[model samples]
Every structure is written in C-alpha cells, then in structure tokens.
Target: MSVNVITYDVGTTGIKTCIFEISDTIKLITAAVEGYQLYIEENGGAEQDLKEIWNAMCSTTIKVIDNSKISPGSIQGISFCSQMQGLVLVDKNGEPVRRLMSYMDQRARRELKEGMGNGLKISGVNFLKLLKSIKITGAVAASVKDPVWKYNWVKRNEPENFKRVHKWLDVKEYLIFKCTGNFIMTKDSAFGTMLFDIRKGKNCFSSKMCKLLGVNMEHLPQIAGCSDKVGLLTEKAAVQLHLKAGTPVFGGGGDASLIGVGAGAVSMGSTHIYSGTSGWVSTVVNKRVLDITSMIASIIGADDNSYNYFAELETAGKCLEWVKNHLALDEINIYLQKICVSDSLESLYVNLYDFMLEEIKNIPAGSHGVIFTPWLHGNRCPFEDSLARGMFFNISLETGKRDLIHAVMEGICYHLRWQLEAQRKKIKTSKAIRFVGGGALSPLTCQTMSDILGCEIETVDSPQNAGALGAAVIVAVGLGILERMEDADKLIKVKEVYVPNTANKEIHDRNFIVFKSLYKNNKRAFRIINK
Candidate 1:
C-alpha cells in the first residue's frame, strides 16, 4: 500500500513543499513553492521576518495538498530539509523575539573578535578556546557568521529581546514548533551550532562546551534524530495548512545531511554536489573529518554512525538570479519583444533562464579572458569573507554581453572545482560526483562542471527537488515504509551523466588558477571598500 507524505525543503529565499506517494517506489504527486524576502542592512546584517517565513510555508503546504487532491487523512506525515546555521530565537509561546538572523548575516564581527579572537591566537582563533571547543564539540566557532556569534550579538545589541529567549532554534526547528508545538532540535542542526559534544554527548547538549562558549544552557532544546517522531501536527497548524491534526511530524534534518540521501549519495565516500539558492559539496564518511583550515567540517548526518564532509557556497544559482535581474533585463524585455513569440509575458519570465543559457551555448570555453565572480552575497567554504563582492575581471571592449554571461557560469564552475580540490586534501571524493539542484537542469552547467572539475557528473531525476525527495525518504523511514536511508539508493537512480570534455580542459584549468588568485590578491581591497 502507498502512503503519502509531505516534505518541506525550506531554503533561504523560499519553501518548496512536495507531497510524495511512498510504497514500492517514491513518486512525487505534486509540489508548491512560495518565496519570502531576506532583509539586508548596511551594517552587514541579513534578516527575515518570522511571520513572513511561516506564512510562506503555510501557503505552500496548503497549495501542495490542494493541488495534489490528497485527502487530509491520507497524508501520513511531514518532515523538513532546510538551510542550516540560521538563528531563530523563540519565546515560550514559540514566537520570535526578533527578526531571524540569516546564515548569510555577518554583522557579528565585533562579537566574534571579542569572544574568540582575544589575547593569543593560532590560525585566526584563540588557541585555548579552540582547543577546548575542539575537545568538546569537534569544531570551533571561527567564522563571524556562526550562530554562536549571532547569539552573542543579540545578547549585546538587543538585550531586551535576548532576555525573553526561551529556546534557541535553527530555521527548520522553528517551523517544526509551529506544526507540532514541540521544542526540539535535530542532531544535525544542533551540531551546526558548534555546541554539541560529539565525543561524549550521545544525544545530549554538552554543558562543558556551552559554558565555555558563554551560552545559556537553559535555551538549548533537546536533540532528536532525523528519523525520530517529533510529535503530531496540532489542530491550530492543521487548520492553517488544511492537513489532519494527528499526522505525524518527523525529526527532519538539515539540507547538508539529507540532500545526499535524496541524491542516492549515502554510501561511504559517495560525494554529491548541490546548487540551489546556495550550493554545497557533501560526501558521506564512515568517520569524521574536520579541517578547520579549509572550513570543511564533517557533519553528523541522518544516520548516527556516519558523517558528511561538507563544503558550501553562500550563493550559487543565486548568481544566475542576480544576472536575470541586473544584467539580462534588456535581452529579456527587448529581445522577447522583437521575437514576438507566442509564449505569454509570464511564460517568457519563466523561460528567460533557458533563453540565457541557449544564447551563451556557443561561447568559447574560456569566455575569451573575461571572468565574473559569483560572490553576489559574499562567500563561504574554502574561504568565508562577508566583505567579498562579485566582480567582472579582465573585461575588454571586445567582451560582449554573451561572453560576460558565459563567464559568470564558468566562474561558478571554477569555485566548485576549487571546493572539490580543498575537500580532496582531507578525504577521498567519489570518482564521479552526483550533481543535484536547479543548476543540474542546465546541460551547459553539467558539461562545464565536468570539464572544470575533471570528473564525471551525474544528474538524478527531478534534480531540483532533491532536498524534498530527501525529506520524503526520511519520513518513509520514520513511517516504516523504508527500513533505512541506505535503502533509498535502490529507489533513486541517476537519470543522465556528463563526461569531462577533454578539449576544454586546458582553458578551464588556466582560468581556475586565475580564479583562485582573485580573492587572495584583492583581500585587503574588499575589506577596505565593503568594511
């Protein structure tokens, strides 16, 4: 018998809610997406209104259920796979005391410097603090953007809001509270906070680490495994979402842990690369691998026994979105007007990205010496620099619009290659990496990425919905429809593979060497201008 489950893949800008029928095979019945705005401040702050986020999820859930025509009682459960490391401080009533501090927010530099960058230091972190943190939590809070720093920023800046904080939660955990009226953080989300002790906690939050970090232990929620049942959907949430009140709610995990399961990259050493609003390269490992220098930390994934060595890009396909709004306005409006195509203006807006890729398909491999950085919203992984901004380098009068556009795509591929290089230093990556995301839908991206990384790239079916699929897999395990996460590998198969293009290797390699130097060469300039 088939059981229906709804999974929410909540991202930085939006929530994608998908309903799937799980039985002999996992099949997507219907899906709906709703977007919310991320508020940016001049002082390097990025936030989102709490009510806006919850409304998006509610609307999308209702839309998905209504579109699927699935009965409220037929839906068995709900789970989530969302962006990690965001700070959502809630009061006892589960209401936010302040706007959400996005993972992209870096306004905590002062707090980070005072808290972890005092007296003596080793590799940008105070030695004693790093040692104590590493001993207890297997990682240290070095980045100004870490949730701990944001917490400190709140305590110091917004003292009134800080006083009412009943529990600190990640993005998805906050949403889960709305659905089930339970206060719990999944293991992966807790680990993202750099407060959970991997050595001794078992599943408990470590008081030693919490004390060392100067955190309020009273605020930390109980940790839950990804497959554990969180609670049943409450009547209030049920009315809002048009779902059954008693439906089960599972402990859904962060995107870094669950997307690999969706991509069928759950085996040891199996690597999967994702590009969405943000991007990441995660490989499942039997043992933990933490390289503070590279900023690639192995996370406790869905299964208790394993880890995901994860590297991230703060902005990925978001660069393409930037291009659509800023760079390609003329082509989309005037060119479409000239073509006088049968597709409506709304349809044209939906297909504009396809139009951009098709126009740049014939551009040369190297983009004729033009290079564009994909740091529109700063950067993470390999390097974490919030001051960094996107730029077009080596542009000449001869550089046309198409060449500049193609170079942006090439730059994104180059960064992914750089991340893979950094990760390869610590662990053995898969021979051929599975690529899943909205970026995977582009054949040009798949081919270019394979050539740039000098490895094979495989795309799974419905690559854009991989996170939703991953959350559905977790719900299936919780519902007893699947025995374990590994079983998902049998059901999700690769749809197509792109081999490295030998002819384009030299140019790509040459551009990548230049790409690596751009950030290093302009580090001081970035801080001076943006700071």
Candidate 2:
C-alpha cells in the first residue's frame, strides 16, 4: 500500500542514489553512490566515460535498494537529475559511441565562433551594458558548446563513431535510456543545449546556428516534459537494481533547475544560488524574457511554459580547493582552526584564499580600490569569452590578505549582482535569493553574500542534497504520489537564514565599483598573457 521512490542524481563527480517512501510523512530509507573521474584534455576540453558513469549509476542504484532493505516490487517509480549540457552519442543498438563530452568542455569554441559569425553580438542591447548586467563567466555566450557542436566534432574528427551513431542525448536522457530502455529528452534538460527554442517549447536546431553547423534535428531525441513517463524499467534493469520492471520512469531535469525546485524557488523573482564545484545564480520567470544581450534564459523548471534565467560562475568551490591544495596544503587545518581560534589571523591575510576572505571581510563594504575578475575557467553568461582570464586591479603592497580575500568574494558577488540586475530589468519583479549547494553551508559566505547583495540569503535544509531530493520529488509526482509541484515545499524545509549586516554594506558598495572596472582595465593584459 506504501509507495517507494528511488532517485538518482548523475553529477559531475559521481552518482548519488536515494530511496524514499512517499506518504503523509516523507522518509528517506537509504542513500548510496559510486564515483567517476572527470577527464580534462588539452585546450580546456573536459569529458567523462559514459560506460563507466552508467556502471556507477547501476551500482549506486542497487546499493540504495540493498541498503533500504526494501523489495524491488515496492518501488512505484524511479527518476533522475543530471548535470546539464553534456553530449552523449549512441549507436544504432543504443550503445554509447564514445566518451561523453562534459558541460565544461571547450572544444566547441570554433563552432561557436563560426555559428555566431563576426565574434559575439547581442541583437538589441549595448554589449558593454549587457556584459555588466549578466553573469559573465568565461563559459556563457562563448560559442555553441552544446551537444550539437560536440556531435559535429565527433563526426568530423571521428568519422567511424559518427557513422555508427543513431541518436544524440544529453546526460539525463542517456541515463533514462540506460535504465528504462527509452530514448527521450526532457524539455528542462534540452533547453540548456542551445538546440531548443525556449519560447516555443520545441527543438530549435533549425535556427541559423544549427544550419551553420550542418546539424540535423533528427539526430537528437524527442523532447518531453519532466513529469512525462518515458517508460518502465526493463526486466534486466529491474532485476539488477531491485525494482519492478514496470516501475514508471519520469524525465528528470538538470541539477540546476531541480535545485531550484528542491529549494522552494518556484515563484517568479525568487533566486537560488548553488555553489558546489561550480556556482550558479538562477531565478524562475513566468515567460521567456529574451535579453538580446546579457545572461542566458534557458527552459528549466516544469516546461517551456516557464523560464529560468541564470548567471553562472564555473569555479567557486574549485577555486577554494585550488588554494587549499596548492597554496596552503599544510595550513588547511590550521586555517580552518583559525576561524575559531586566532583573532589576528581573522583580520588580514594574502594569498588567494586569505586575500579573498579578508577583502570579503573588510575593504569598507566593498574592495574600496580593488576588484577581481574570476576567469579561472573563463567566463559564462554575460560575456561568453573562452580566452578570458582572471585579474585583480589597483593592488598595493599595503593591501593585505584581508583586502584581497574580501575582493575575491566581493568580485564573485558583484558578478552575481550583475546577473540579478539583468534578470530584474527584464522580468521587473525579481527578488528573494536562496543559497543552495555546498557553499551555502558557510554562514560567513552566506552573510557576506547577503551584505554585498543587500538581500537576505536563506539556506534550505539538506543544501548539499537538494538536487537529489528534487529528482525524487519529480518521481513522486510522476507516480501519482504527490498532487502538484508546489506541494514539495511542505515536504521540504529550510534549515537556516543569513540576513545582511548593514554595518558592512558601505564597505561592500565601495569595493563594487572597483570590481566593475577590473574587466575593462585588464582585458588587453589578459589577452596578451593568454596569447
């Protein structure tokens, strides 16, 4: 009489599976997972072995079933949430043709250039104003890096693989096929590929961009809604994962969109910030507000009926890890302990982490005379430039780690603010920011974000696992266990809130001006150095 739902989150680093019972009281029975490696090749390209990831998914699913001590027949449905935009090609027999190209892969740079023609151009807005408005991580607007481009790359570079390929899939759809023996793309996942028309809720590969690349829309899978049932688990999959063969499978979405749902960020003007390996600031809109310039407006949430505008930063936690591993490897515990012990160490320090922390701490509400452009992996959203790199300006030896630290955090915040401003301008009612993902765990970071942005930052319960929970909620809806998407808020709860400290607002405001100027002042220098 009870319904069990199993959800899998195919993430950048690994696969996580959670088994839960859907009833008046939602209960998590068990969680399990297996890890995978991320391959980064030359020229900023990143990839993952599709077969290996699938194996991990299967392994994790079985592990969760076993851990839950529940029989396969008890599960009514299974669903997934996956990293967005990765390209996977399959043979006629539904076997992978090659390794999946990850969202981070930059091999499509040339394709983007050729597709856009004459560098990057915004249709109706000032390029500079647009750049300052959207989240300008090096990745956004850089070029056509969707599966279409990657598929073409394979066709040109590896003709044999292309010849054997029958259908192309994003990460989520591929995983669905592997589990349910169905080949379908969810609208939420397809929207991010740049191959779908967010406005019309249909595949938009026919746009000038696809024509330029000689891509056929037929090569991609048919798009479906997130709640649409693609198929039931096959006998083999059911037996292997301890689930019923006829168990329904719903089309899951990108982790970003699901995170929004899981965090109760369903209404218009509500923003959600996810900071894991990378970071993103996303807000839902009732309809498409296509800014001829600025941030990306992708179809997320339930369908093309709604829109999710995002300004993403590619490396927030990753940058912190880089500093921890390379710069202060020996002082990690020491620095972490200092947060609770040493008062002087709290005041100022330099190096990437220390400087970033301090500038975020002091620098008179903003980095008074400093700004940092985070281009560790290039920019996304507003200014799509792959060749772009990071920079810090107006630095003096007098500037200690505190100032630098504050500058780094403030710099990232400034970019987030840029995204918020752009979305607000287009949507007119955008407000409320919710922080999710791993970075949201830090009270200090959340407080800093609230102060710099002058908005309240709320951390949802289970911040780290919101995406996985979101996937489960989708499954619950698909299986007829939950009545509506909005009902999820009652099932989910927020754990904490970080309000702005007006005392630091003045300093943050001052530093924001410097942060805004870094890109302009250092553009030529960055290009030269990269050259």
Error of 1 at 276 (Å): 0.6
Q: Pick the candidate with the highest lDDT.
A: 1
User: Which 10-residue window of candidate 2 scores lowest in summed lDDT?
Assistant: 132-141
Model 1 spans > 4 angstroms off? 331-350
lDDT string for model 1 (1-531, tens) is 899999999888998999999888899999998999999898989999879888998899889878888898998889999988999999999999999999989999998888888879976789899888887777789898899999999999999999999999999999999999999999999998999988844567888878877799999998899999999999999999899999999999888888899999988899999999888898888876778788888888898878998888888898998887778666446463454435665475457788788889999999999988888878877987888988999999899888988998998888888899999998999999999999999999899999999999999999999999999999999988888888999989989999998999999988988999999999899989988
Cα TM-score per model: 0.97, 0.84
What C-alpha lDDT do the candidate models reach, one value each?
Answer: 0.89, 0.70
Candidate 2 per-residue lDDT over residues 445-465, each given as its tens digit: 788788888888888766767
280 Cα displacement, candidate 2 (Å): 1.8
Give the clash total for candidate 2: 35
Against the hidden true structure, what lDDT does model 1 obtain? 0.89
